[model samples]
Target: MVHPNTTPAQLSSILRKCAAASVLGSGKQAHRHALVSGLIPHSTLETDLLLMYARCGRLLIARQVFDRMPHRPLHSWNILLSSYAQSSLFHHSLALLHPLLASGLRPDHFTLPSLLKASAGLDHGRTGAALHALAVEMALNVHLIVSGCIVDMYLKCGWLVDARKMFEEMPEKDGVVWNAMVTGFTKAGLLAEAFNLFQKSQFEAGDADWMALPSVLSACSQSGDLRKGKEVHGRAIRCLVLESDAVLSNSLIDMYSKCGFLDASLHLFSRMRVRNLVTWSILISGYGMHGRGKEALRLYEEMRREGLEPNSVLFTSVLSSCSHSGLIDEGRAAFVSINRVYGLEPSVEHYACMVDLLGRHGRFVEALEFIGRMEMEPAGSIWGALLGACAVHQNVEVGEIAARKLFELEPGNPSNCVALCSIYERAGNWDGVAEMRRKMRDLVAVKTPGCSWIEVNGERLCFYQGDVSSPSSKLMLQALRGLLG
Candidate 1:
């Protein structure tokens, strides 16, 4: 309850505290107190109430407060817009700009960044370009924050050329801008370009910021460039940033694991002074990926003994480890424990892993029964897992069932058609294979070709199926044949 003599300033302070703590109940109480104290018409108090609700994720209540405001300042509009964007309600955020314009309020630098972020989330390149134009019109493009957001938006929307142009044209480049470009290239699977930019940032800035190193490490992990990964580790150590940042340390562990250096990953893990759930999760996943399920489970138990509760992601990793190692009984117990032992519902991923485990061992009847008992509807991943297992075991009848469900659920996925065709081929059903090909043609579903990356002499090379255009392809093939011989 608010004191009877509470002034507007005191009430505003209370609202800020509630917002900072994200205490929606306290925020609502403050709102009631403001109303009771006849402070409803005060602009500052009303705006504070709106911000409190917005920060607490009570967006509908915040909107109501905003609408009821006698005067909605530009700051209030920005808060609402940012709240919606941050919540990933992209369409709702975009819709608010129209009313703001209709109210004769021009968007300032703060407004455009949120809209740009919303555009990026929706992958709406046209909307993002329009916002960029508006920023230029208002001469706000010169602002570092606005320009960085534009670059990030363009990159996320897959407009790499535009993003690069904007990035190159920036008069001043800070760590935020550099990180955006480097991370974008890394995510786009252009590891060479990402590393090049990372090097360029070091040359220009005299040192690499701790932020960009994680993306570069991720690129190294994806390409299995152990040399590059170690180079980055050394650089992080020289910069004295690795020990201070858990996220960077996690990235290093992940890179080493993916690069087929489990011992190095474990050594780093043991040396860390503090370890979080993510750190444990990465190590467990690494063990699973390398087919060391027993070790993975041991580490998982160790994590539990440390008093940290397992989340859904950790459970998925554990189940996946069990599936890969053919520990069907262990997988089943883990699946049951997800709900009964931990009070966490088994997600679609957990169901898929269980199906894969049973189906992989040719237990079709048991797999089907398990599917029937699922609390939620089976998704495309579940069917896809069953179909993959069927192909492996040459189970034509169950393969067809899985493929049919996959076709209905994910019609555009050509992998399903391919899996069913493989099953038919294994069973000597030429007619079935031809008919499946006809369906694939009708659906225009073309399977993506396989690709691989290799690092040679500090350069990353990508190879696609039937791609022999590289000058060294013949030499590499001959070397591979010689090694096999």
Candidate 2:
């Protein structure tokens, strides 16, 4: 019943249609028939076969089919590039674009977006800018695809100024474009800008029922702006967006805690109809941050009792709580149980917490040995903990060793060098102290400035270590002088 007139192009079109329709079973069966009938040797059929394989997540088979293709089309190249990008192989994705260009396939608007996205994921901002220039050179600037990709790339790279400029220059805007701008501002700690955009998207009435509210709320959490955070929460409640979604709920919990409203956070957590691991982790991290270690541990027990398993992040939070509370044995037991019981690998944060816990309890030697015995490389934080302990115990020799190790690990960090200098001064070794300071000036040149902030009427005001630009500064000084007289 075979039709002799049917060509390989027709058969490949049918297979691609089936794949697009999500009828994978039938497509696979057709593929087997095509191969057995010697029809799949056609280049057109090979493209369809590679796309089918990639769609099914059989990347190895996809790559094999792609390599065997006698002729490749731009569409086939784009499919493989997107596959690698989506699979988080950014370098592979970017590198594949080269061969596509070499094959005389001029990248259209569709091709550059995925490439720009991959470059962003890889933090290759220079490559991203070069792609933008190419897009302009190719006269693809008006393409929504190119514009949106640039927005996302700039956002991911934390270049908010460039993102805003691109956003402003666009003749037309879309929801995705606005979302990218809001997300970028939020991630870059520009709470005011994110909030303004969120408000503007609501037709300028301050309703802010837009999708950007969640991201703005995240920025408020970062800035610890409680007043603004409450406003966003109220808007979420009115919009009916936070009740059912676990991620939003977890974010709210984190936001409330960061704003110093733990009671509200606990209430919100308890009232959550569904809770995920992130929910428990957020509350635990909140408690740890606020020095409520006992509450955090209690919640950990409750989490386990409720049939939720602890992951590495949860264990790290609990270990941090133990460090804050000087619970050496509890921290040690939890560290061991993370791998032994929960099958979670301990990260560097857990190791640092353990060292801090032991060192805080005056067990300096044990902390040093613990760092030495770690299965992973001991990071600077661990050495810093031991050095701080030596400072507390006035152990000059141990302090010197810990400081040296920390300096080696983080050679450009001035804090470690300064700590060693202080330890020498305490030990009356003026020569050693002078040498440490001189080394700090030479090798670790940067100084971390003091930071201050004030919250006034839901707005934040920041002051640097030596700033005196406040309007009330002169008045405060005069009032203090009058009180002294």
Candidate 3:
């Protein structure tokens, strides 16, 4: 009894409702209605059908509809490609790209973003480079969306040089583009570059632009540039920049702590009008990091009194405080009572913290027993903590066992080998120490060179091993020797 004059527009409306409601099971009925109503599906209508099926997770039906389409529009092809990408069908997405090219469909911005997303998800920068080349060939590289995708794809593949090249080549930059480069540089530990970009954003977008502030603040925190962080904080306050933004406040608190000014961090935490879980977590972790375990615990009690739930991260902070302060009884109580009291399971980090606490207090046997009782396999940190205790207390039997496990767990970690050597030396086993060095030489796992960072006048400076040929280094050496005397 269906009408014979069903329009594609009518079918599209029905399909939209189905897709939005995630009731694509009814899509089959809609398709049947289109068929029996004598409606000839147009390109737009078929694309709607494909999207409806894909959105409902009925990918097989979607492919069938795609295959049955007599004329696939460019947008329709992009939709199908996105469908596959969204479903994590990465290989299918990559394979489908060639056919899109063969069909004389030049990829637009939409097409490349989806394809580039798939490439990033797969960590295949070569394919991404090829896609970038295709965009350049089409003169679409300068398009903001395409350019952003290329920068993101390169960064995701750990190709910083290429990422920076793409970032610098952008003709017109937006807040998002600036954020990507700043965040990328921060994550890569290129604090100088991140700060420079942050400074540029200040002039270009002004202090009112809070887009890159969080990334710049993070770089400042990690680089220990408290002076620079305070300047940025002053700018944000002057701009009245999103004062309601809790994340920015949290980043400010974190930067203060990382700069060795716990009092300033504490003051900021106390002054915050709106504190989220991150705010509390950062505050407690900050106090704990400064080795003020009692203060961290007091804050934890205060946080709980405020009716905030304690998560696994909060518990980790509490446990780390106990470890650092050698609060055996409190650490033990927290470790055993985590699940019972807080309804939070102790993660690997919690277990590792307990091991560190027990091991540091000359409880190697107890630490190993705890590791044995863990539901999951003990990770490298757990074994490393136990090994460290053995090195300290010279427990040859336990040290050998822990070192052997560490060797298997982290074969490429030179520190593990060095720690094992130290344990053997502590036990006066010269042959064992010699053999350990020989094995390390064979593996070419040389100890990582030591390095340190210092922040001065909002700039970060680095000093590395064998890097003291500069004139300032002689002055630094003299100062160090004076301090030693």
Candidate 4:
């Protein structure tokens, strides 16, 4: 019960503390005290209660409190909107804008960011653009935080050209803005553009922001640009940036591993002063990538010995390593350990890895049985793995079953149709191949052509299937044919 002499100021203070600490039970009690103390209609108290509930993730109760407020302030609306956006309730967050504007309250710099974030979360570029226009009209677009959100929303919605325009037009670019564009380019698979921006950032700022380094390393890893990767690593060292950043170090380990320098990855892993589960997972996955399942398993055990619990991600790597090496027994043991030893339920990825392992070894019967016993509905990856294995083993019967399920689950994926056609061709079933091609044409399921990238003379070149646009294409194709012959 609230003390007889307790002031509204004290109650507000108590509610603020509850919100900060996420003490929902205490916050509820305080709400009760305020109601009993005849503070039910207190504006400050009600807003605090709303904020408390929102911060505690009790959005329904927060909305209830907000509805009861006779005079809702713009600050209260922002709190609720931000809460919804942060919780990824994008629709609910956007819904608040209509009521907020209808109530004659205009959105401020604080309001647009949350709404823009919600737009980004929903991939609603049009909604985000409208918010940008609103910000411009309100003269709030020039605000640093609001401008950053605008750029981020555009980038996340895949409007890279627009994002670049906004980024270039910004009168002042902070580290956050620079990192957003670089990271956006990296995620969009424009690695060269990402690296070029990274270089420009370094030149303009006189030092690379530690935040953008990971994205650059990721680009290097994706493109297999070991030369650029080494340049980045050396720059990190020279800037003394890698000394204190575990994330940056982990990215380096991943880069070296992807570049086929397993020893260098291990050496970096060993010298690290701190190692998280992700660090261990990266190294184990690197070993797995090199088809060293035994080494990966050994590291798994070592990580366990050091008292680090393995999560689903680590188990996926372990299972993948076993699949690649065809270590069925080891894969079984590791799959069983996920639930029995570690008390972690197997994810769809672990199930997919198991299917791949069994199907690759021509154990179709056991693989079918395994799928039958799955606790959850098998996802496309699981069936795709089985389908891929069918193509490898040239098993037309099992391939048909897997492909049918894939067609239903992923109608847009042409790879499954293509795989079945390949299986039919290998089995000398011309009729089946013709039927598959007809189905592909009917569904309009066009397969994306295979592409490969190589780095030479500090430049990355890409070659797609049947691509002859390059000057050296004819000679390269002749050389490739000779090698095949």
Candidate 5:
């Protein structure tokens, strides 16, 4: 309750502290008490009230108060911008910044982080750099959070050299800064660099730093580097970071599964005391990747039984498993169940999976009909799947149609051209095959070679398009050929 003569300043302070602590109920009570006692006028109290609502994930309430305010401070606009960014409404957050600036509110360091984060998601590196220049002009760009945001923005936008330069130029690097670099490299598929950085990060640690482990584990998941992942897990255990953390356990499952250790993935999943949706999805995806569709479906049912609805990703994994294992009925049943039971509207990815499943089963006509009936345009993958099935079944006419669709969808991708050529080859159309090759040449499309790697005696050995570059290449090739035989 507010005192009869309480001032607006005192009430604003209380509201701000309540918001920072995320005590929404207390904040709401205080707001009501302030109104009843007229201790805090609506104009002065609106900013803090909006902040409180935003902190509690009530954006609509925050907007209502912000819209009703007679005059709002620049910080109030910052709070609203931050609220949108935090909620992952990035485009909406960016749309508000221009109007706020045009109205004469100079964005400070606090405002730039959210804006940079939104730009990162959109891959707008040039625009982000322009904003960085604005931050410098305001003398607010040197702040740690803003620098971190710039690093993250460059990394997400695939400007790795710029990201590294930003990292190197920083006067002081914190755990958050290092973690962002690791995560950025991992997402860009720079596995060797991520691991090298993880090794270097050990000497750069502090007693209180705990954010880097999750980023390191994320690198492990992407790179399939089991040894490094285990070493990091050991350190996490020592730090008590994974004693009961479901998120870390899910990461462990993903890393282990990628490394082809399904047993270890299952073990980690079993040990998790509190499993969230991601945990279930990781396990489902792991099982699908390993071709254990029955087990994947079993876990899917168990997740629903435990009151967890399968998201689109979970359905993707289940559908992929069914497609790979020739479980056509099971795939169809799961697809139907997605809409009927979980209430998740099927996406283009789900449609692609369905086409793959049907096409692989030699239901070419049905697959074509499904593509035609899609609520949205068919993506390259859907057409490519039908084309591949036609190639396997030696159906020239259907393959030709699918090829035309694939070519139109992904003209720049040489894989589609190769698919069309393969279809021509299967149909004994020598001239058509030559024409497809000529088209590839005219388009300057080069097929990217497939590469694989394996570790031998603690050294990674990589092979590219049958290239022999390793010191032990001959022995490795012999062993592989023996296994093949």
Candidate 6:
């Protein structure tokens, strides 16, 4: 399949398209084509090929290409940095920084982003701070895009104060920078802040770009703001953002689903012109979330019939779907296929899904045996799922075992205590329930109060557990009494 007769320029064009589209298989074929064409490189074509492999998530191949380069220019080093950064191989990427500088190739705007990204991925606060200082010293931060990267680096390192300071000090604020801050704020669970900033930016910036909608929509989704989500959906329509952007479309579907608007989600999904793996994943997850497990399984089979291979994430969604719908047999089959057919080793998530599937079916002993057989350690989630199952079925003995492990794994979490108490109550063990409460008090395990928000008149109205100090408290009480009456 190697196009040997293709010119280097033509091959470069193909690779660039592959990189941009993220068509991994085609990109690998092009890399092979470049190799077969005897395109000896220390040249631009090879550099582009290196970038294609890296961007396509083929880091090992990208490293091989990088190692073979007889004379790599600064651009090549930058590409390698980006490849490692893109693959989330932060440690490996950081290892190359010194050798790259040692070769006497100066870092440029492109180089800074990759290095910052590696620091962000690793959550290396010290390294990220040093990178920020270097960016400032080298005048790289003056580049508006690199400035955004710096903000992102700080946020990823959990240095929220530093990130905010950097953002405030930046002389320029473009859409990209604003979007980065929005994304970071959303990731940090500061949805109210993200929403406020998003609204503020919309007022000042005139019109929103496609990048703004995702984080904003995500905030809307997490906050259960169907009203604001609809507003963003309208903006996406007006901007023609939904026409060509699969990612934004998927986010829209997720937002709709989380807001309990299944009809809207399915409608948009049906209307999408192009559906990629992510699109399928989102839709499948949406169905699973809503407990439409059979529908999710149907969609999975349909995806396979279309010749799209299921990745581990897609498998996770399918297994989760089975778990939610109580399709134990189906879940087991899908879990087995993950390793047998797809050859992808089951991750902890997949194993957790299988355990939940069995546990939900009252197969506690089988679930524990399965956990014992797992190649990897049974994580907190695995045991937690078992604990939840015990509470549901009031299996006091198994629940106690799960609670012990969960307590060791997550010592401070009150949910496990709550679960044990509920199981004890259901099993008619009053003393056991009292003992659990006493244990919680002894451990000083103060539970975090739950809170929720709703959008009304285009604003998020916050409420908290046991809160009665709001102006509407009297009205709320009256309404509840009237409803009960």
Candidate No. with top TM-score: 4
The Cα RMSD in angstroms, rounded to one decimal, for candidate 6 relative to the true structure is 6.7
lDDT of 4 at 162: 85
Off by over 4 Å in 6: 1-115, 130-140, 203-208, 339-344, 369-376, 425-431, 441-443, 462-465
Could you tell which candidate, 2 or 4, scores higher by lDDT?
A: 4
TM-score of structure candidate 3: 0.90
- Stretches of model 2 off by over 4 angstroms after superposition: 1-10, 17-29, 41-44, 204-211, 389-395, 425-429, 457-459, 464-485
lDDT of 2 by residue, 1-485 (tens): 22445567776776687667755676677677677778866877888888887887777878998888888888888888888888988887898877887888799887898899898999998899898888889989789879989988988987777788888888877766776787888888778898888766655323434466668779989877788888878877887878877777787899998888999999999999998888998898899888888888999999999999998888988998888787677788899998899888889888888988888778877887888889988888888888887787778888888988887799888887778888889889999988988997798467777676878775677767656788977886689699999
What's the TM-score of each model vs. the native?
Answer: 0.88, 0.88, 0.90, 0.92, 0.80, 0.75
Model 6 Cα lDDT, one tens digit per residue, 25-124: 8777877777666776738787887888777777788888888888898988988887778777789888998898789877899998888889988888
Give lDDT per model, in order.
Answer: 0.91, 0.82, 0.85, 0.92, 0.83, 0.86
lDDT for 149 (candidate 2): 92
Model 2 weakest 10-residue run by lDDT: 201-210
Span of 10 residues, lowest total lDDT, candidate 1: 202-211
Better of 5 and 6 by lDDT: 6
Residue-level lDDT of model 3, residues 278-389, one tens digit each, is 8888888888788888888899889989998888887888898888888889888888878888777889999999998999889888888989999999999999888888
**Superposed model 3: Cα runs more than 4 Å off:** 1-6, 17-29, 38-40, 53-64, 84-89, 206-209, 342-344, 392-394, 456-461, 464-468, 472-474
